[model samples]
Target chain A: MGIQSVQIGFKHICIMTTVLIALILFLSFICLIALPSPKEIIESLKSSEMIFSLKLTLISALISTILVMIVGTPAAYALARFSFFGKRLIMTILDLPIAMPEVVLGLALLLLFGRTPLGTLLEDIGIRVVFTKIGVVIAEFFTALPYAMRMLYSTFETISTRYELVARSLGYSSFETFMKVTLPMARSGIIAALVIAFARSVGTFGTVLILAGGTYMVTETLPVTLYLNMSYGNLGMAITSGLLLLGVSFITIYMVEKFGGRKI
Target chain B: MSGFLIVKNIHVDLGEFKIEDITFIVDEKDYVCVIGPTGSGKTILVETIAGLHKPRKGVIILDGRDITSLPPEKRNIGIVYQDYALFPHMTVFDNIAFGLKKRISKKDEILREVKAIAQRLEIEHLLHRKPTTLSGGEQQRVALARALIVRPKLLLMDEPFSALDFNTRTRLRKLVREVVSEYGTTVIHVTHDFEDVWSLARKVIVMYRGRILQYDTVEEVFNRPCCELVASFVDINVMSGIVVFSNDKTIVRVGDIEIVSKDRVCEGHRVKVFIRPERILISKSKPVSKFDNVVRGFIEDLERQGNILRVQVRIGSICLKCISTPNVLGSLDLELGSSVYICFRSSDVRLLVES
Candidate 1:
């Protein structure tokens, strides 16, 4: 074949592959939609077990996101601004969870909370974290901390340190300068990070399932509910939870793009 | 009077360049210009005094107190950057009021001070507008107003006018001079423009390779540079030769040419000669005076740089560049490859110390 014919043939093959992928995705989406009408989905969503699971999922995720922000702001700021020994090693270890599979992370957390002296000490203090409501939060936190930290670190990095210096020169102390200048500058980034962390925590499956044991109504979140119902052959409840999770993710991404995609 | 602000042997090593044994003193309300080429640690030097960069060695004393270890906030020094660096999110009024709010508690007083300074800078109308919405000159005025509203003990500007157009630069220079004099703020401005020195500074410090080469009055540093390096960096011509005694005066010879200098140098001692380009006069024929230095050379090139014309004449291996007005070139009918007489007074030939 001539060069032009070969080029046209390659373009045709590329279009065909793209169309095939789109077709498969669309067919799967249609199948998911055809499985339930709005009335059936709403009925399943309003069921007592689904209601409890969804409420617990949202509350635990919100708490986890707040905890992540409160603890991650300082950690991310320190990583972004300061140079000290072992910083690179610390940064690499912090990012390790993002690279590792969530199942492995779940197994590691399980061992730490189930088999370690630290876990026993916490249990003696009446803080039971294994297979409880608190366990769901702990699992979500472990899954979401790295993403929150990365987003916040990039946010702090984008801001010039000169703003703080200028504030300091204006007769304000370091803490005051940060409160007045740097925090306001990084507001949008912090919001975006909160949304992402909350979304990640809500959808967390492997970590929550292993640590919280997918118990019904007591420690079950939406993902755990979906997993439990799928194992029990309750297809309607499982698909309803899946659709709810998808809706939450779409809203979170839309809000992030609308507000945080511009300058910090 | 002797100790307004003293920097005692400050040393900082940032890996690329370091300031070693740099020391200077600025009297209160002194206008000092630190002139140097790029990457000469000029910004580091000023920022060190502003308490932004902690010196690796030595102390910074301000107003009879040691502020070397103090944080930038406690130093009370205002710094204006070349980029203007006004907070993009804040309006001009808010930007100017930022420092004032930290000091004064009353809102009316802050408004009065901001308006007064803004009016002085002729940026009062831009008070409600964000910094990004203002023009470059307006933003610069707001930056100045913000820095000055605080009435800082020391004002440090790093090439503040380098970003503006020529007319705006000249206008801002005049405005800065007026505002600084009215405030009587001790100022240390770092710039590469010689016009900043000529128009604003009473004292000039020429820096190179992270060291102060010459620190003296503007007249002293311009007329009497210390060495060949300072001469070249300052764009002055320096020739080295022995001083020969002739007719109750001394003459310095470069190659086969002899030129009389009014400045006294010891016979048999080598001295560095300095002359500014604008001090020389070019003529088609020799002038009437035979005592001054006059040389006949062919004009190798003529270039009009801005409003001034640069005439290069070939005299042996030494090519001397003289700056003249376009009117002077027209009157002399000078062109390339034409023989011309270059005359400069004996008093204009400065004999500097040879290293």
Candidate 2:
């Protein structure tokens, strides 16, 4: 065969692989939605257990995303802007949650909150974390922080330091320059990071399951609800929870697609 | 001692590029242009003075105040980069008003000051547009207005006009000259373009390998460079010759050609001779003038650079570069391998140290 035909064959194979995988995923989602009658799915969604799980998931993800942004933005900026001692080590530690298995991260968190002195200090202050509702937010926060920070770091890196110099020459302090120039230029990136962080927080299952105990009707989130109903062989409730998580994933992908590119 | 700004023994180590013992002085309202090749530490010197990069060892005294350890915001120095570096998110009006807001609180006062500078820069109509929406020249004017509105003690421009077309650069040069004079602002402009030095510089600083080669008046630096490197940088011809005496006049014999000089040096002593390229006059035939040094040579190479044609003339073993206009080349009908007579006056030759 000639080179042109070989190149064309390679292109077709790659494209065919992509299409086949995408079609399989689409058909799987369709099977989940079509397995149950519409009336049964509606009833499962309106049930008290499903309602509590959905509310808890949304609230915990919201709180965790906000907390992640608050701590991650400055950390990412520091990583992107400055060169200091142990920066690589700190970055590797931050990326551990993203690279290691979610169950491993959850186990580490379990030991920290259950058997450590810091966890006991929090209990003394009446701020319970382990096996509590607050534990859900804590688990989600740790799970989502690395992705948010990675996105924000790249965003801050794409912004030239010359803009900050120009602002400084105009008599603004360092903090003032960051607020006026850096933050404004990073608007789209921050939005994309928030969407991804919220999505990651809401989809967290293993971490929340291990640390928050995944108790039914008390600390249960949407993912936890899916797991609990699967164990009880409640197919209607399990399929409904899976559908809700899929919807959140689609919205998150759309929002991120709208705001991912660098604007300034 | 009467200098307005003094940089004393500055040493900076930036790993890739460093400046050692870099020192210079600028009088008040002097437009100093720093010209050098790429990676010659031109930008680092300006950034150090702007307090963006602190020198390892140096003292920068502006207006009799030592701003060595001060932050950029506290130094009262304004800098305009080659890229303009305008806040892309802000309107042109807000950009010009940014520095003014730090000094003026009221909105009306800020508006008035911004309007005044914007009108002076002829960018008043572009006040509502973002920097990314404006043209290159328009964005540069906005940057200049933003820097000048605050009435800084000194302005540092790092090749601010290098990004524009020739016509726009010429126009902005004139605008900057007029506006800077009106504001009485001192400027340190770093550029690689010779036109910028000729048109904008009152004093020129020639840098090479992170060291100041020559810092003097523009005329002196162009006409009488101190060293061979400075001479080459300013497009001056540098040749080594031995001092010879003939008819009670000091002359230098360079490669079988004897050229007289007004400067006195001991006979039989080796010396370096310098001559400006534009000072050398080329002719199709030797003229009747006996006072000037005239020699016949063949044209070795011809290259056109903009309006000027750079002709390399071969005279024996040495090659002399001659600058002539294209019109002159056309009129003289000069071509490769064409024989020509080159003449230069004795007063133009200056003798310096050996090698």
Candidate 3:
């Protein structure tokens, strides 16, 4: 009886999915036909604000991705390979950002950078983060770190420790083995993580808005550009940025699928 | 030689498994096979010797030099794993050349060494291919070549043939023995297969529950197991009985059965006797033989394990298992409840030393 009901449920799900896909296609078609032409979209894209936001988004996303990989690789490797005091607590805290709401993370980062000793230390060092382009990268880094670390952690976890043991036995030090063997084996996963982190950083909005304040032509990433322009009743500019963000997401996912060969 | 390799009082506690008071030694070029069941800390002990694990307390001396604190890489020891841990990104040639590359600076010389070793292992044809494309036997040979090409102080194998089919395993065992002998490399092989112990091992170390139970020559460990656990692990029949007479041959009586063994034992002393299953012969009727021990019994059961057949014959209250070939079973037409004669030479029975 349960099997029969499951079979019926599967049939219903298949029908529902087909209907939902068709509805999405029809709505997309209507929107495409009703909206401005590609010429107008291109003209809007040529605007100085649009160009600046796109450039800033790419640059900051690249920086954030590099930062995330630099910090996340070692963090993930340590979590996957070692056992020390408070390891579970550290892992739990690392994973907390993944489950926490974006606004909460954004507000937490804002307070830490705006009111804490770290903020004052940075201020004394002449490194102004809050309300600056640097704040955007800092926010993007925090937002994308959890996702990048999760990918890298699982990737390192999938590789057996025996490979390192074999390398060590072959007269290579532990660090050398990791560099020559483990890192090479985990290359695809690292590439996938970079792609994902870059995409996440490019699309980040709430944290950037709270920390960088989303000022026009200064700290406006693509998501912030979309939000700021939409609030100003600039629908074409907002949708153009939206389409660019969608294209970036599409390209990143395509590259990850093409090169990674495994789901990240 | 003066104990070429010595492990003195090694102790390691790794939460799940621990080794305590482990002490053993192997002469130079001695092929020692460590046999134990799963979770017996056999792999851990070898890995510790390879410097993969730091023993909480111990000293590993190789050729009279203490390498207790040396890392595996610095120790110049090679290891071959059961999975054949070849680098997937590298060609077979590069995989074999990796360690040699680190040692030698010349590229052409590295190529020459790799080609020579590959030719020796008969993997020259597969040198350009990736490891994933090779068969289990080919991959194992490549792993062995990679380890042996380094010419390390010692070579360790962790159940290198356990993953292969029976035919592949036997073939690779012969190949491994030949290659290691050609290299004149000292080896420590860990295996659960007694065939490996019999065919390749010069020395046998039997381990149970994180401790060495017996370390001796292959013949001694197989023919004369040290304890009941080693006896069962080695699949030899162990019986505890009282010695009744001591003359040219020692006679032992178990229950109402009398068995004669050539091993020296005091008369009227209680002793445990071990007899290998393959040493016993099955005949349809009582045969004319002066070899002494012959008992008549009915076939209780038959079990086919690989090529050999295990025939269970009941002699009074004790049910003895005798190993025979399929041809013998077919020729004798031995069936259940058929009366048969179980014959074994007195010299084949061993008297275990009491602890």
Model 1 in CAPRI terms: which quality? medium
Deviation in Å, model 1, residue B157 alpha carbon: 1.0
Question: TM-score, B chain, candidate 2?
Answer: 0.93
* Interface RMSD, one decimal, each candidate: 1.4, 0.6, 2.4
Candidate 2 regions with alpha-carbon error over 4 angstroms: B245-250, B263-269, B288-291
True contacts kept of each: 0.60, 0.83, 0.71
Task: State residue B244's C-alpha deviation in candidate 1, in Å.
Answer: 1.8
Q: What are the RMSDs of all candidates, in order?
A: 2.9, 1.9, 2.2
Cα lDDT tens digits, model 2, B61-121, are 9999999999999999999999999999899999999999999899998998888988999
Candidate 1, residues B215-245, lDDT tens digits: the string is 9998878878887677777788778778887
Residue B171 C-alpha lDDT in model 2: 97
lDDT of 3 by residue, B1-355 (tens): 2598999999989999988889998888889999988999999998899887888998899988999998888888899999999988888998999888778889999989998988888899998999999999999999999888889889999999999999999988898889888899999999988889889999999888899999999898888988878888888888889988999899999766899999999887888888889899999978897658998889999888878899999988888879998899899888889999999999998986454
Candidate 3 wrongly placed segments (more than 4 Å) = A1-15, A18-34, A262-264, B353-355
TM-score against native, each model = 0.93, 0.96, 0.96
Backbone clashes in candidate 1 total: 0
Model 2 clash pairs? none
